[model samples]
Target: MKSEYLRITGGTPLEGTVRAAGAKNAITKLLV
Candidate 1:
């Protein structure tokens, strides 16, 4: 089987002391 990939073309701007929290998984879980 062949795997397929999707592409997203865009730009994200983080301004004014933006930050990513410590755990990504925790963030994803929290988001859900």
Candidate 2:
């Protein structure tokens, strides 16, 4: 079986507070 990815491709502004498990800083660094 194959895996699929959740992709968001478009020109727009995403505004909101996204909370996840663990440190928030870690998530930001991962994005960078």
Candidate 3:
């Protein structure tokens, strides 16, 4: 299977309170 990736963009400093939901069954790696 072909690999799929995500593109994210933002310009603000992340502050306080982060909520992550779903995406536990993915076979891709996330690089931050």
Give, for candidate 3, the lowest lDDT window spanning 10 residues: 22-31
Which order, best to worst by lDDT? 2, 3, 1
Show where candidate 1 strays beyond 4 Å. 1-21
Per-residue lDDT of model 3, residues 1-32, tens digit only: 96544554588664564333555334223425
lDDT of 2: 0.56
Residue-by-residue lDDT tens digits, candidate 1, 1-32: 96433233458643453234556455445434
Give the TM-score (vs. native) of candidate 1. 0.32
RMSD of each: 8.1, 10.0, 8.3
The stretch of ten residues in a row with the least summed lDDT in candidate 2 is 1-10
| Candidate 3 error regions (>4 Å) | 12-32
lDDT of 2 at 3: 48
Give TM per candidate. 0.32, 0.32, 0.24
lDDT of 1 at 16: 54
> Which runs of model 2 end up more than 4 angstroms from their true locations?
1-19
How many backbone clashes can be found in candidate 2? Answer: 0
lDDT, candidate 2, 1-32, per-residue tens: 86433344568876765564556566565545
**lDDT agreement with native, every candidate:** 0.44, 0.56, 0.46
Give the number of the best model, judged by lDDT. Answer: 2
- By lDDT, the better pick of 1 and 3 is 3
